[model samples]
Target: MRHRHAAAGPRRPRLPLRYLLPSVLLVVVVVMLLLRGYVHSEFLADHRVRPPAPTGTVPEKVLSGGPVLDARGETPVSHRVPDHKIVLTFDDGPDPEWTPKILDKLAQHRAHAVFFVTGTMTARYPELVRRMVEEGHEVGLHTFNHPDLSYQSSARVQRELAQSQLALAGAAGVHTSLFRPPYSSTADALDDRSWPVAREVARRGYITTFIDTDSEDWARPGVDEIVRRAMPERPGQGAVVLMHDSGGDRSQTVAALDRMLPELRAQGYEFPRLTEALGAPGPHSAVHGTDLWKARAFVAAVGVSESAMGVLVVALAVVGVLVVARFALMLLLSAVHARRVRRRRRGRGRDGRRPQVTEPVTVLVPAYNERECITATVRSLAASDHPIEVIVVDDGSTDGTADLVEALGLPGVRVLRQPNAGKAAALNNGLRHASCDLVVMMDGDTVFEPSTVRELVQPFADPDVGAVAGNAKVGNRRRLIGAWQHIEYVMGFNLDRRMYDVLRCMPTIPGAVGAFRREALWRAGGMSDDTLAEDTDVTMALHRHGWRVVYAERARAWTEAPETVKQLWSQRYRWSYGTMQAIWKHRRAVLERGPSGRFGRVGLPLVTLFTVFAPLLAPLIDVFFVYGLVFGPTLRTAAAWCGVLAVQAVCAAYAFRLDRERLTPLLTLPLQQLLYRQLMYVVLMQSWITALTGGRLRWQKLRRTGLLGSAPGALSGSGAEAREPHGLYGPGEAREPRTKSAVG
Candidate 1:
């Protein structure tokens, strides 16, 4: 045995070098693969999941009435708006190729129909959606994809619903309380998950669709039958007739719509979305059917058909690229603006010295339902170091804002209690009462530093400067939410103000602390009530009249931010929607009104990109990134994505670095990259939708007092904290504080 073993060892000593080399190479390759997988999994895990309820809606009490809906809350309703007045609903589209033809036909016959489109579909054809809105067609949602609601998880169903909701909002400029589930199915099986989904949606204030009739065009019916099915002989009240626009060969359906839309209009059927129906009283007063059946049909039909996911993916990518490019251009513009400022300063030389002041200053504080913060704000104003006269315009605040202001026992702080006109009206009233040469408008919730008035007025020393925008600092930032707002204020609003200064085409002089020449404001006809963004409206007005708006970075105002996400959402929604209204109202200047119209060529475009396209693209990129990581070839994309992400992270970090105290919230920045950022996109899209539909801009008040009383992990309105000052300069120490109260 020993001899045999020795012989075998001798034989092995003659082994080939090739075998040894191959063995070593194979081991190295395996090790590298393992390392790669580990890195990917770790990074993916880090960047994929959202933190515990960092962003969410406040659980509002259900608006009483309407049957409770299912998981995919497509409730059935019996409200018929009359068979002859059949409203044609084309869902899942606004297809560019087909929808335009449909629109032309409808326009030719002076007809209108409701389009309940999928997010995927609308995104692919934003122009078509815009056309629908421009042509006066109602746009609703048919879910993001055509996923069967009955079989999907509640989370999946909600995501789907949100997809369409966001798409219609982002693409078509419409917000509807109505939604239709895929395949006309509802998740109403009394499942534990389904009920919550339904409840959550209803709590968010959406009315579930209840289709009273179906055209069955999705079933490949002949054009004649489709037309016949859609055209009810006596179109009943609240009837939502359904048909498809994008799924497969809808030419026949389109043709059918072309022929039948005019006929139906001739019959006196008013085509209104389920949204309009929800606003008005319907046939059923919220209780004619069982919950399950009610969820199944809600006197509406969402014409849904599937589109290839690829199209949406590509469209989203294109939109995203455009947004990113626009952002880059904006940054460049900011840089250019800074250079121009430098050049102008050098050119002016000794004339840059501050001039002696002879102008009277009137500070207008518009008060809404802000009783809690009104006294503090007014007191701060009274304590200002500058010579000032104060006027507090209470815009029908039921919270006794006027009473509190009147009782403040401060001179020169006169309270003007008016009926519930908008902020625009309040501003106009303030302007009329102002006897000062310089008018400073402030939000009632914001308090100013003593030197703020002086600094704000300094820019007005340059007669060319029509308005001066003061820097806004977060007044309450003790909690994480406040800290988050601190970052937002410093990074988003503050930085933009600086950039705007460089550009000399400032889009807005925030109401929190804005200074304008009394003559300039008067010349512009005060503030236009037609637009919601009064500050932006006046800014545009000044620009249109060949005036320059300057940003006063040194002039600072402190304001409280909404402590809850719901409050934040409501506030932001109003701001965004109002801004859009302002843009639309001033759209005429976008083209060549002349070289004097610098606003249309530069400022207006800047506003559009910053507010609209940036939001649109940011979310789309997030969606694409998620999909690529989840489904694409693994490990390879990691390097590329890391580079892109690195740039983004660096940019974001730099953006907030100016306010170091608030920079800590950047740690949560990565967390938002996972999901919360995407949610923001959804909210932005919804705001756009509501704007397009002419939804009321009336402020929806958020309950704020019980923030600290709630539990942290309660999944409700928890995570609330006590209000306190926070951000770059630390707590409670104002950089400047001034008081002056002079009655006119």
Candidate 2:
């Protein structure tokens, strides 16, 4: 029965904005992670490069004076720490590992120092920056990203300072006036290249601080050597010492600090913060109001990005393991299944010989608006070598599909007309009218070979066999889009079926070409309209009813594949959603007794993991592939991506060999992975969103070109079976019946 139709209303968009919100959020997270990686890799000074040769650009007094220079006025003035006092300034610091140890040593010796922190490190380890302020240590800006200021524009220099201050305000709620340029040493080392950078710092109201003592602790020198190099040459002569608490192993620096601080204090030397030794006012000013809150938000974003990156790495590892495991299992079990089939064909089964099945079969084709394909479909069934009764169920097609089939007047073919309901309802109607014990179902756009029916029913010779999945090929694979589907069908779908068959937990019998026992269909309540994938739904029902399902590789059918991306997306979105629907509808089978329990435990997990979760996480591989290429080490990144591609190519080649297919189509495998794979990922993700949100999906129909009837050899391995002519009979032409099969 059909439901009453309502008048058409205003058109609604296929995908609502709510359905796309989750994807947009995911993209935001990925972008944040990329930004974090770029900053971490590109910034933060690790080792110093030699400065350029000196030029006449530097002022003579500024170059020959002490380590600290005040250039904010017309004439630059330089100063050193007062006699009997030492100022310890650490660069590239706020390190989570070494900074705490150095601070603890300073506290024990009752000394205070200055930490010149890079903006990147401060943003990452905010607590360390805050502790510096609480412990009475001065914090000075070391610039953000640690770039060579001589090579940067005035605007870039300003941005670097402003960003550093932003991080400081966010972390410690303070702004500082003291600044240190990266890769700087004593004032005497200032060359033509670095002179302008100093002037720019002065224009920005910063007191440029340079170091007089060179510890060289960044090179991991011995602790004793570091302490010796850090000391002033003469007694009562003060100096500003340079050291590091971050970037590589800082154990030597930490150990050197413990020994040097107490010994210097015992010698009547005082270690004071940089400002204290200079007798100047404090450098830091507390932040307030909106500026403080904005800085806090920036810090919070960085923390979230770090946490998201950790989870993405774990997801990447899980996806890698799942992909490798799935490949290994498919290869091993498919070989076993093929070998077993060969042995049975050679009469080597446990019974020594197998029984043959030659009974007539009923083929049901449920079609809606498939007028262009019905003629070829009916003729294909009429040409089968084995006797078969063809029933074309036209489910309220606006086109003249039923009329066209009746006009053909082919022997042993009939047409049934009914109002539009859905595919599952149409299939159930066909099942009610089927006459033979063994029934085969196919789509209106699919064409079968002469031996397809005979080969499909052979598994029924075993009393326990209830359903058989057939090899469905793409018949319009001349285009690149079609070729991609061809590879997927041969490699992904068929190989998986072989593996599942060997495991005795076959999940789905494809609707394009599959045969079923009438008794099994009745036991499973025919087909239900509760899910879009009626075939998968009924197949699970049969498994739960303790019926055996298997695959028949030799039974081949050629079906037209979508040639455009829009059509393909529509088709796949339906499939992905429908599969989820079926999985959810039959989720309880896992805990049942008998065959239901076996399928629930084995088949359900495999389907959920490989079909759902793996694909959801698989996009991370490509995401990181692009990330590595953009960041650095291009050759290594390209090599790693090629390795993953090589694995997939090897598996695809083996699958093609098993299917007796030519390898010409494999030239596009790389492009398929780059482009086609992302489309699938998006489609699967959309399905996940729909399922989680409890959104409803309607049936979508794809337009057919009916190319299989005219060009049967579009794909490889069709053999001699596709040579029959496809011509409609004239109105007066009558074909004699080969078999007098009648419907009960």
Candidate 3:
């Protein structure tokens, strides 16, 4: 005999570090992406502040001074580029296409220029920044993300400058003290709004640099126009020329640079670096040690995040296609199944008029510690409209469930006691003693309606049908947890069952209520204990044995669902793992010929795709949903999420309509997706971890409240009726029966 102590209940294992590390890395990548603002374009938008109408709050000397300003002392100092020298400074660059051409043209002319790079681009294409430093060009900070710092707070400005420095340090192992605010042009244009920002930049030890001339290259003006505009008006006058090599098509700027560099040199105006033109010390400083490593790590993380985002985008697309395809298949096939059932009811087809099944069936009630529910279960069976001989196999319940059932003394019900063998073994024992050709199996906690047995057996009228799966409804659905499960049953389970039935690949006959032919059971080698989910294992076996299995939607049974999160987790964990085990056990059928091979090709793949693969990847939708909300466009992200939810709601509404259920329960569908669905995903993930590590799972019995038995009318549309107890003995007056046996 199988003892309860032989195997231990499922225990929580310490999460392996391998799994933990990847999760941590993913979180880090997401954070890096958010910090870099690479997923959104708002940071890169060209924002102009219109010079703010010139205010006296700005220092007149600073406003009218040269492009390079330093205000570290009480008296602000400014210096202009030397006469007959031109400082060519490019903004918004490190562009892989245009920056190189501009750099190459300058190199060909032996001319040096300053390229002010944005932190976003610097981090993304570090090689370009490295190349700028290698080619004897000055690299200055233009603020990270190219934000207009005049409108930003001191803290925001500090962060921008610090991040830019970090990017510079990471890319080329050097940082520059020169800074430029995005959207600022010409020192004379600085007003009260921008003058204070320049003072703050000077206070931070940076030489705030502005332009003396605007090339207007960003407008993609003609190359000749750009070159002409970039030149100083006077022959000997010095100028700091502003142009761009990034932020849009810069081919015009590149051509302009190619013509202007040598032409300016030919005009006796030397194109020198900004610091050289200003006659100041070099601003670039080499980074070392921990700071260098940290900067490099930051850049490495940004690169990884970009790559990971690409992969996630592809995964999201794949999930999108899978979800839409599954929904389409379910909606179409479920309608076909419903229509066929309607036609059968109307007697409109060749095989529509099936004879009513009236033969007595032996119902097996497998009980383990089910004293609270045994009485109502036996009474409900005795009240069945269709004749049934119920064998209540009490599998070593410590609560005296066998004595309680025997005491009830229902006329057609017999109590058989045995040692604490597992549920599958108890089922097999019950099957051995059944005298009826048709057998119905149900859990001890399930309460069937008066007509359930009749409707369940009606499918047997077709000789090829070997088994029928019944509709299992949640009885305690007034609670939130139960309501979520009710929605899942209606949408995820029942609707999928309809589709699977249409495809002739129904994977599971739920243990709550199902019926099978004795010949089919015998041919399939009875219920085996190899898998925790005996019902599913046996169902797959019958398919391989060449017997047809189908769904009986009219045969509805009310069973209590798990009430708490902990209970739900344990129950689903077992179900997930057990289903995987059963699928793995029947894997060989896929390679075989005949009915087994047919089931293997059609049923196995569908089951794997819908049940295993789809759900495993489904979490990516929510993952990216959160990612988009944080780092991407909020309106689009929310709209996409609602679109997916709306599709789910449609499918759920149709499922409820088909099952003749009320739609009020669907109000919690969004919450179910937000919270309840995540728990199920975690359960499935843990199951995968357990399976991959070759961990064993034992049977877990949920704590029942006997709610289904106590209140049969609580479940709507279950067709349940409350019946008074009728038996040979009163509730507590009978002795134990003699039909007990031990199994070895």
Candidate 4:
């Protein structure tokens, strides 16, 4: 009905250029602004980094140097990638903000410098440490207590250094591999300044830095006097200048930076991170220098020219685009296939001749403590408008389900009783005595339409179709939560049906309303109680045996949805976990040649990537766009982000249009991006861990809302078939000829 109405809507005409010109102009302006921002950020990042360079001619100088391991051998401290370098040193400071202010000034010039931070100051202002790393600055360790090196004992110094290292690691994600001694001068009496501290730092893999130049007035001097004092000694190649950002007001130092940083970067300085300057790849792979190096290496290894490498990168990107396009095309094709199959099956013959088919259906409804709804189930079945033997399996229902069935006295409505075995077990027991050519499985809580049974059974007219699933709609969608679920059901189940129609691989035939051939169900073992997701398990089992499962969208049922966040979470957790379990159980058939192997080349990857990776990628995509906004290389970077966002919006809009929903929820897509989607990760992680540990989890019972709560019709009292001797409680009560029996 919904589909028919959608088709009837007046077609919207395409807008003319006059209508679109403003939009185009707006887009262009946005692109230009983004590009401008990107360029500015790149320039600022390039300019602010530092290690003072050789003065006379080369503005930005690159130098290679390292720690003298034994004052005899240069131990490699950092492995600088070409065009990127790191500067090494200590901070907090000389009990001084002057040290850090000077450091900040160097950073403005785009020079890399390491700050071995004191534990005391780090504790006071850890934000500075975090900002340093976040802004591509390296953090090293100064001592914990920040005592003068000459006054501290060997053991005391070691303890202080260790504590500081641990503190830095814990607070700022920095594991210090370098240390700087206080004052950069050793005391001879105790060898406290160098030997002992050096040994302790070296033992922990720290490369201690020896500063080549000091402004000296760190102890005392006027800002102007200090600038004059420090300006004469021009920095040579790889010169480490000591400075501070904490401990004192160093406004003078800040003043001098306006003169020094840009002048120096303008002089040709490459400010690499300390680690990069010392010749090591930085933490993230996005760093320009490292990516270029890796690309070069890959090209070299493949014996490809630079031009070939460029071609390969372009080819890889193009392939990704092609794959995504193919996937979308395949989805559309599947939808068309499903629609055709449905139309063919549904089309009645001319002259109105009845088709010669007398296959009776045994509809099984499994209920647990569902006395209130059991009557509805029986009444709906009695009203099915098709010949169906309704069997309600009462799985340990302490409620008056049996009493209610006896009172209803409905013909062809039977009640089968069993212990509190799970739904799967109850269904299996009920199936044993089914005694019909076709079987339909449903939940006691659902109420089916009068035409549901007829529509559901229509698909079975084709021998190729083993099972058909009915469209399950939210029976109570007045509340926000239920409405959300209604939308989700339409998107997930409906979308899947379309895809399956094309691929002929239906991953699930929901237990709520699935019709199956009795023989097919028997061939595949009857539902087992082991898996939490019995419906998914059974569907996969049937699919494994080369049976075609289908969707009967017009065969509708109204069922309950979780009404609260907690209930919804619990239901989804079980569902997600169960789906994963079913997938794992049938993993071999995923990509292997067999009756169940259709999904290997396409379906499996699609399912895994879309269901699993898509949620994870959501956060990353968000971060990427935000980063581009904050620190884009050129205005084009911002424009690229807008392009990405625009494309996503279009795709989402198309999906929503296909599903036939109101426009209000479409706006919630971005809100879902902020909160709802993140829940996927939490559920996935939990489900994965549960699977790994083989932990048995109890079924999460969703609390009732009673919003659309109406009592179901009573069940008809019936016992198991005598011929098969399959009773509800146990197998084979008394062997006899198998015949259909609907008894109370």
Which numbered prediction scores highest in TM-score against the true structure? Answer: 2
Model 2: lowest-lDDT 10 consecutive positions: 735-744
* Candidate 3: worst-modelled 10 consecutive residues by lDDT: 720-729
lDDT by residue (tens digit), candidate 3, 1-744: 122632334345555742454355446655755654652334444465545666678777777889888887778988898888999899987888888888888888888889899888898889999998898889899988777777788998898889889988999999998888888888888877887888898888898888888999999889989988998877878999999989899988878877887777787888888887777888899999999999999888778767777877787788788899999999999999999898888888576587889999999999987765677777777778889999999888777789988888678888778878778888888999999999999989888877788889999999999999998888778889999999998899999999989999899999999999999999999988888777889999999999999999988777788999987987887788888999999999999999899999999998887787777767778877876786668889999999999999999999998887889999999988888876776777777777887877655677776655533432332353322112223456343442322221
Off by over 4 Å in 1: 1-310, 330-350, 356-358, 634-642, 657-662, 702-744
Question: Model 4's lDDT to the true fold?
Answer: 0.57
lDDT of each model, Cα atoms only?
0.60, 0.83, 0.82, 0.57
Q: How many backbone clashes does candidate 2 have?
A: 0
lDDT over C-alpha atoms for residue 505 of model 3: 87
Clashes of each: 46, 0, 0, 55
Better of 3 and 4 by lDDT: 3
| TM-score, every prediction | 0.53, 0.93, 0.90, 0.53
Model 4: how far is 628 from its true place, Å? 7.2
Give lDDT for model 2: 0.83
Of 2 and 3, which scores higher on TM-score? 2
**How do these models rank on TM-score, best leading?**
2, 3, 4, 1
Q: Give the per-residue lDDT digits (tens) of candidate 1, residues 172-265.
A: 4445655554454212222333335445565555545534457778777788898777655354444557777776777787777767766666
lDDT by residue for model 4 (676-740), tens: 55455455555655666665444644544223332121121111110111112123322223122
C-alpha positional error of residue 472 in candidate 2 after TM-score superposition, expressed in Å = 1.3
